[model samples]
Target chain A: MAKQFNQLAYTNLDDFVYGSCPNPVTTKSGMVIGGGMVYPEINFTLPGMDINDVTMPKAATIYSNIIEGVLKRAAELYAPGVLIEFETLPDFTEHPKYGIEVNRILLNGMKEASEKYGLKTAIRTTPNDLREFSRPPVMRSGKYWETMLELYEQCARDGSDFFSIESTGGKEIHDSALVKADIRLAIFALGILGCNDMEFLWKHLVDLSNANSCFAAGDSACGFANTAMVLAEKGFIPHVFAAVIRVAAVPRALVAFEQGAVGPSKDCAYEGPYLKAITGSPISMEGKTAAGAHLSPIGNIAAAVADTWSNESIQQVKLLSEMAPVVAMEQLIYDCRLMNAATLNGQQLMFRDLLVQSDSALDVQAYVLRPDVVMRISAELVKTQDNFLRTKLAAQLTVAELKKAIVEGKVKSDKRDMKWLDKMEKAIETIPDDPNEFYNEMKSVLDMDKFIPSEYGL
Target chain B: MATLNDVSQCVLDGDLDGIKVLVQALIDDGTDPIVIINDGLIAGMNIVAPLFKSGEMFVPEVMESADTMNEGMKLVKPLITDEDIPSKGKIIIGTVNGDLHDIGKNLLVMMMESRGYTVIDLGVDVKEEAFSAAVKEHKPNIVGMSSLLTTTMMKIESTIKQLVADGLRNQVKIIIGGAPVTQEFADDVGADGYSDDASTAVELCDRMMSDQSSSEALSA
Candidate 1:
């Protein structure tokens, strides 16, 4: 309820500590046994080779071993009066049922490690392989969210207090945006579990421009975190936006005033730089971009905002194509092993120093017609970007243009496109935009007439 | 007195309930079930397929339309005798082992079925042995495989190998599809062909079937 947020007077980033990441480590031996995306970094540092070179079955073994090492490390870090949290990359559990069993075995070990070692400890949730399917009239959550929540719920029942929502799927424009809604909705649903201590460690949402990189799960986690924080900051429902170009010699500066959270599947890796730069209050300022299993898109997003009201979790939406049980499942190992072995400091710092141009400094009129300006610029940029789905700026900017067309009587006022667009843009228009309402509006657009029921067959 | 055009309209409108009411009326009028299926329902699906390829219809809408066709088929099926049901073809489809995504695979099944083909959906995470066993059991005209992830996509090749190892590869034509699949990928995997989407998938199956029959006829 909007009433829930009116209760909060204010919340700020000063309430937290600056988290630190690790530098690239050296291999103790010539043989790189493990400690990369596919292995637990207990004895071995990252090797020069690709993590995917290790078979998945072998990687699964390494992942299980990593869980064992986290317990060992936690025991050493634990003290009676102190609480410690660490990142675990026990990615890609074999079969869902067997994976659950493995999780229980590890959780029992974790609880034992906590009690025996005399420390309060928690590990972030690991995502299972995702499979979205269509079953006519609904897009069912096949193995992806169903298995994730099952594992999450099992952890909760078994005394795992710290939980995060992790989900991954659909790398298209409408698809990823739909995935965002699914993640937000899942996070909203999982919030009821009373797991207030949430963290962002996910299978990345957007695709990277790097020819070498696979999907970066952490990038998704970070964007989710930013959206969560942004949701927390505004403290209200209605959200609005104006698409604008604030570009300079380096492209990073172009995004300053907007503070946008871009979600695209490929080549739009800008979300990573935009995400890594944000500093916010979380359970811990620290995070681990480990080489996780390239399966589920981790959905749960959490930040320790300066102030968090109970039961106030982000609520987004779900429902992709008209078919409920027939979602497409496509996978990429997305081994970010080389980068995962290294630190995020380079990514954060890389975007920090770029030359920036500004449009935020313009007059109030510029702000009022910002969406119009977005269209003009995106239209120009479209010529440069052959990969349209990879970038949401033009599509969203066009949505902004579509709205202007309706208002000026150039398009039908009662059109489904206009109605859904109006709802989303209006939600985006709200100063403290409602992530729930905004996400739902975008989702509704996918459920329109032309997309489904038409006088023509098929 | 309902013509086939009326049946096509029901499919286009994605009106599941309407399909039953109209099909029932035709049956009441003593219309032959085979004619209803061939000229009515199948004709409607043929039109829908093109619209779908043109992006005029999406997955959800197409699925809805497909659902309507299935609904109409229920009434027509029982009425049409085995003599009237000379099978166009039979297909066995499944997503490979460790690869559970099946939207594309399922879509192809629906498209093929509408064209008077029988389909056996083996479902997601199907193992190689399962494919061989199913091919033996069903003796399908085509064995369709799908994998959404690169990690599991290799299973497509392995499954192809298993089919050959089982010696069932000669019995059935193999077609594969998914997000990462391509014509080159299809060629490398030694597949009969690749389909970029569900529409072309049916076309791929039809062409393969025609070729198979043509070769058999030539040999005879």
Candidate 2:
């Protein structure tokens, strides 16, 4: 059975700061993830590099070198500790045999670099979700699902310290809901389908971690909320709508912890602050530093309460004087150093407050990410044990706050944006608190042809 | 006693159940199906598209309006002959192989369908052979491809190549869209058109269809 958080771990926002978790997991490399100063989680990708389908030798060499170069840069910068995340491109993990070999080589590089530089190092292996190998993706069982499990098992056996995945559980429906901005459907996708998939997927992931003595860090709503944020950034969707979806995704992401994921949730899950408040799990957050990966309104404010500050992911391409990943390492070390300095000076709270105030009122999306705002919505969220109710309550609280902020002129808004607020509020009100009724109504009203209920065990 | 205006209001409100009732009422009251479709359902959707572009309307609202119009379409469509159906063009669309991302593609589908283009959605991770087969079977006026991954986006070029090899490339106009897709890339790959957003994709299709019709008129 997984550990479940039924109440807020830290009632006072002041009690909740970066670099600490109530239950921090210590890695085998003797690096502490939480309960200390903030560390940089370096995530980098192949620079427009494609993995060949036939052989592993060339891909393995290229990837292993990237790892060595990043770790070497970290050592030269005198960075205290680092968690290097290898987020596999789909082609990497589509075939488990080649994927396992690639992972082994990358882990070898991390080990060598750590021994050479005396730097505290750990590795997070995030396998790409290949469940989309089939249309109307079968989440619970299939050859694709089996391949995902095989990659995780072998990666753990190969000495991966942390296991994470940006799992695509309810993405089929969630994608449609996002484009349509259907709050009711978004709730069903996130609360019903997404929560169910998390419990099922994480149960096995947590079990694998326990058997291999690895840490099952957590999942991210990177595909869901982050997609909404990007669309909002492009002016394709309203920022207010993205803000509401961000809060709505919290309870769904919290399901991962409910199923036993520990501290330091994935980067790009901008909903980290709310999950941090509720689960007290140290979360990895990327902000201004993550601009190379994606842009958003919550850049500075996203770092306000991050336990692990990260540059979401940079390509291994070169800048003028140095490689891009190396440049990112210098930037991240300086960022974590500043954050760690504040913690050491006993002025972390003052720094945290400054971070929040800088961007919270600038964009509606940023307003919801404020630590105080995360706390208020999270407080009401924990009142219910049901994931669906928690999702609804979170959305309700966030919508109320956003409306008040718009009226008070704290966050800029267009008069037309009010219709969205009203529509969202009305939609939330109409959803029956009963999950079963909501599910059935969604079945009737939604484009059910695009969804497979059996996959979610409905 | 329901008027066509009542059907339009239901679509504007995105009241799915109300749209069903109002559309059925008009059918029972002896209204012409095409008039109800054009003046009522599509008319409401026409207003929604601009509002969406102007930020006065949001995605979900526009989606609801699309769903509402679609529901009304289902009721009125059966009453008309295939030749009488108003269509801007037919489109075969999908996210190219190795890329499962389709939120953008699905939005484009909705927008295209709302604009009276008959879009046959092939869904995500669609292989090159599948696109060739779809073009052969559907004989669509235009083919659309989408890819959200830089890794999988190369599949678009390969898929277009397959279309050319299969002798179907010149038969249909080819367009592409997605996050990483650019007009420069599209041109490099020999695509006829590219769009960054769903609304603009619809407009591109409109322009492509018009140009195609104009060329045919000149040939005749």
Candidate 3:
């Protein structure tokens, strides 16, 4: 069961299918190895050099250091490949052409790391981070797309092992059919350039592709969830994730088992799955360390599947033991009792560290049950992004509804609090009982609202 | 007949060709250029603003309608005399220095223009000195700074300081906004106003200008 992928000389889909096996087997000579994108931090330049001043060749050391840190852990966990994305900090003003320099620096580092560790490397393009890097994506324009393809062609020539082509249709082209078409056209171009060993962002494309593409959709609580069964018919590569809402995780576990996609490449333990389900960060972070929370049951369920597939205990008793306290703390955070206690500083990271790393529920309860600790934790997470997004969305809804309620004479003058509750209850009545429909329609509305400034008359 | 409704619809639909044809027919029909602009083209754009703010309309479509407004403006501009032109106020706006995000500023500029204000758009990634220089030169009634990064948003304070240092702070109303900006941040930074979105920014501006006029009358 040793996986063999032609570096970048893929001709057909069967080559990819051979690599993306449906089941994991424990054989020293052959394993259906899992891989993922790594954001292991490194300067990518001389150790102390400014990020803007980073130049290639000398930068290979930084890449090697970063890739080495990420891969060593990945390998320790039995995962084989790692995806590298070019994150241009500051801006892409220098070598802004298709992020060529940035990718070269990463590729050089990957080549060094692969040789050093005997691991596979893939450049994930779906969550390109180009926007953060200060450049538009290929899908931004035909010319940009053509130019990006040429740059990738150069990367293939310059020794990129594999490419993960995920087309995230931006504001202008977000129709599902258009997203698929964009991915198809991109794959066609990459194929023409003789690129191989691919990961299509969506599993359905992998199911339909002639290029043995495996699914690399990030663990967006629902990545490839809609069609995991369809992909399981071909091979299960859909991400299995925990959801923020508890009830949603059950069907997810079933799909993961049905699809045989026990890959860490598409799993998020807590905030990752929750955020991805609501927002569209399919391949968010793979680890739960940063999120500082547990995935209710999906995390264990996913671990159990891995345990069964690999025939290893994959002990999470310690991880699970830490959860009860965090669960209680999360309830406190969710209810927002912490915000009224004090203004939090540094996002109260001390709480995340203490609560997430507790050896047992007893330790967490003893540590967190104190008033001082609760205040510290609450204020910090309130100011933090995870809470901010959820709170902001709720606030926006209430404000919009309040205006409507006032207009409709539903709320009488001066009884604001009661009127707000009345409006909120009325608003809840409008949403159907179906969770799936609510999530889908909410996602659509949010996507439209979030479209870039130009759409709003900019 | 080229009713204001037709003009409004053409602009809302982003029919540039139709606007050119219809606006010219209105010119021949002896329609007031001010009415053609205020009740027709601008009426279409005003509809676009709230729809866009509410997320019912998209940017590309809004740009089309804005472009129609511009086209109709070209047709109607010469017809209105200097005295016929009603000045709302002057505004200087830009995405603050080191920030490339300006979608909000662009929409605000379009909305301000339709409201009959002269806007000097400094464009994206404008440096603090550049903002100060624009203020010094343009002498606008309001200075609007935009940013999408918390890191770059610090530059908003610096830009404000630069304005004060340049002795231009008292000459203008300062308003700040972006994804990360809050009304609390506005007060913290000593800005006169802060709005979360573009449409609200226009209303803020109008209200601020009215306040300014009331103050001036009292001072007088």
* Top TM-score model: 2
lDDT of each residue in A275-341, candidate 3, tens digit only: 2222212222322221222222121112211111111001111235342222322222222222111
Candidate 1 yields a Cα-based lDDT of 0.41
Task: Give the 10-residue window scoring lowest on summed lDDT in candidate 1 chain B.
Answer: B55-64
- What's the distance in Å from true for residue B144, model 3? 1.2
Error of 2 at B60 (Å): 2.2
Which CAPRI level is candidate 2? acceptable
Residue-level lDDT for B117 in candidate 1: 84
**Predicted structure with the largest DockQ when compared to the true one:** 2
Ranking by DockQ: 2, 1, 3
**TM-scores, one per candidate:** 0.48, 0.91, 0.44
- Across A29-56, the per-residue lDDT of candidate 1 in tens digits comes to 1111111111111111111111232443
Q: Taking the tens digit of each residue's C-alpha lDDT, what string does model 1 give over B11-118?
A: 877899999999999999898888888778878877888876765554445566777888998998787676676457899999987665554576677778777788
After superposition, candidate 1 runs with Cα above 4 Å error: A1-165, A168-458
Residue B197 Cα positional deviation in candidate 2, in Å, after optimal superposition: 1.4
lDDT, candidate 3, at B215 = 98
Model 3 spans > 4 angstroms off = A1-458, B81-84
Off by over 4 Å in 2: A47-50, A55-58, A446-448, B1-47, B71-80
